[model samples]
Target: MPRRGNRLLVVGLVGAAALTSAMAVAALATGAEPVAAGVVCPNPVDELPAIPAGARIQVERELSALDQQVAEANERLVSTAGQGGPNFAQNAILGPLRDKRAATLERIAIAIGREADRPEGLEQFATCALLGEGEQPAPTTTTTARETTSTTAAPEQEQDDVAARIACPDPTGALPAVPQAARAEVERELANLDRQVEEANERLVSTRGQGGPNFVDNAILGPLESKRAAALDRIEIAIGRVSDQRPGGLESFAECSLG
Candidate 1:
């Protein structure tokens, strides 16, 4: 083992290194120009909360929704881009919102990836188990006999609803071609929406029935509220992407909003 003084030196070095790396990452992500290496950020100690091993399933759930959102929207995005549009004003509104939505989903995926780097996060993937209230890991259910059942039957209803929602566009009518700028905006908006939904769902599941500290930190309560606030911020950003002179008839930027 290292001597006391050596251990203190090592601990300080590790903390400094972690803070420096985090600063670089945040700067790059935000597109901020780097300051001198000696310049410290205001909150050097800030760190993402450590995801528990028990939280792996929650992380996975967020990831799955995020991936599905992006996958489902990809074709629709291309279709929107290829079709003729009423122009950037009407078209601009929808495309960007869609793009932001996708980005939101992507963010959830990214967060999950980060969470997975933790010790508990990695172990959870090895089996079908749950972390009990006391941090003890065990098989998911109480009864041993019930554990044999598989749970993959829920997709039929989902698929049916999707098929119903997207009726084929008019055979005779030519859709407007989506401008390149509009399509780019659409993609960005979709990503944003994905993040918003992911955070929301994560909160809902986490906060279900807990109280006190859990209530304060879990998504079911506080996290959902935070996600809601984030969604509003994203919405404002999406709206600002549109021209101010947009015609008066629109109720929303979504496709379903077009009269």
Candidate 2:
């Protein structure tokens, strides 16, 4: 009788192990496994104030974009796991994400301001974190890209504000009057030019401490000039479609300076 009882227990244990393995296999096959743990960002739009009816559509679009940004950032965090040093997550993924969010939030405020009072303190929503189990919530203090970079910046770099910032010529400043047909497209390209500058400045802030002396020019400003040049070409094409006189001297605006 004792031998039979031990045999039964052993069979039961084997059955349980097989069942667990089968379940795991089934989960994998069905793509039901949870994503690997990664950075989680907060949604600021959830806490947004009442949006005016005139601004509702643009506001909602920006809000949707905010969600998409977080999803992409989290995806990057998972894919680039163990790729960089301790500050890798911050400098590469989270910093750029925050800069993008800040820009988006500013757009949201501008959209709202066109119809109603502009929202204040949206900067609080910019920063994100990789929260571990039982970790404290992300800091709520409103830290701009400049302020965040300044804290860890070398003293000499901090002394010269120009070294820490970018100055790009405003492409729209010398533009000819855009025809009604080309106005919308021209405005969009102009906006892209502005976005290119904003991104370059943000990159400057995010990568302040790292890289060699020429890193800013090689990494940030050079690519910005290329992007601006492309945008300027698009603007000229947009104008050419609607007007006989395409804008000249746009190429001159492509190059940006560190200031």
Candidate 3:
């Protein structure tokens, strides 16, 4: 009876050891690590200025591209581990990544510039760092309710002082039937008019709280009206070139209002 008990205990010990080995293998196969290690890149988009609606699509695409660049760099870092010298990661991986990030950031800035003020010094966000073993990315700060209210109060007040966006009449809808010869030019001008409104609205949103009560009128709307008027004039000319009956009073639709 004692010998049988000892045999059972031996079998139990072996089973426990086998389970432990299986778990370790499973962890490796699943890429499950208690702590992550490799390169950690700062997300530049997190610091980006508010994107205007006109530029939102391009800006988002560039942001996604930046993420892809970081992922590829990290994969390279892991795959080439222990194969290169100490500076290999820096020269072969990190430096090129920084350049790619800088170029992508420039594209984002340009896209934003088409609608609102372009941000400066975006190249500063291009650098990345290698994280040692067991290290984690820095955590973002969390503000308490009281702190959040205090910090946001001024901005809210400023927003109240400014208009949210601008509204403009769509002159294209008011246009008469177009000739084939003038359709392309007229359509181009119509598109330009739409772009003008979009840019003005974006400017209004981005420049809230700046200037005086008449800021929207003196700055955004006035300039936008002038641009719209010019585009409308071109549309009228385009139609007149192909047809005797040209669209009249197009310039009247150029003036925009703030909401």
Q: Taking the candidates one at a time, how many backbone clashes does each contain?
A: 40, 1, 0
Per-model TM-score versus the true fold = 0.21, 0.41, 0.41
Q: Candidate 2: RMSD over Cα atoms?
A: 25.3
Clashing residue pairs in candidate 3, if any?
none
TM-score for candidate 1, residues paired by index: 0.21
Report how far off residue 22 is in candidate 1 (Å): 26
Model 3 / residue 236 / CA error / Å: 32
lDDT of 3 by residue, 17-108 (tens): 22232233323333455334455554343245545647756775676676677678778988998988889999999899889989988998
TM-score, candidate number 2: 0.41
The regions of model 1 sitting more than 4 angstroms off are 1-183, 206-209, 212-222, 238-242, 245-259
User: Is candidate 1 or 2 superior in TM-score?
Assistant: 2
Quote the lDDT for 32 in model 1. Answer: 53
- How well is each residue in 1-259 modelled by candidate 1, as lDDT tens digits? 1111111000111123223433443444344554432211111111213334334345435434433433343334444554664453225433443454445434433554663553222221111111112232222221121222212325674354233321111111221333443445544644654554454444334322222222222222223223333433444444445644222212122211000
- Native-referenced Cα lDDT, model 1: 0.32
Candidate lDDT values, in order: 0.32, 0.62, 0.62
Residue lDDT tens for model 2, 102-208: 99889988988997788887777777666433343323322222235546787776777445578777777778888999999888998888888887787677555
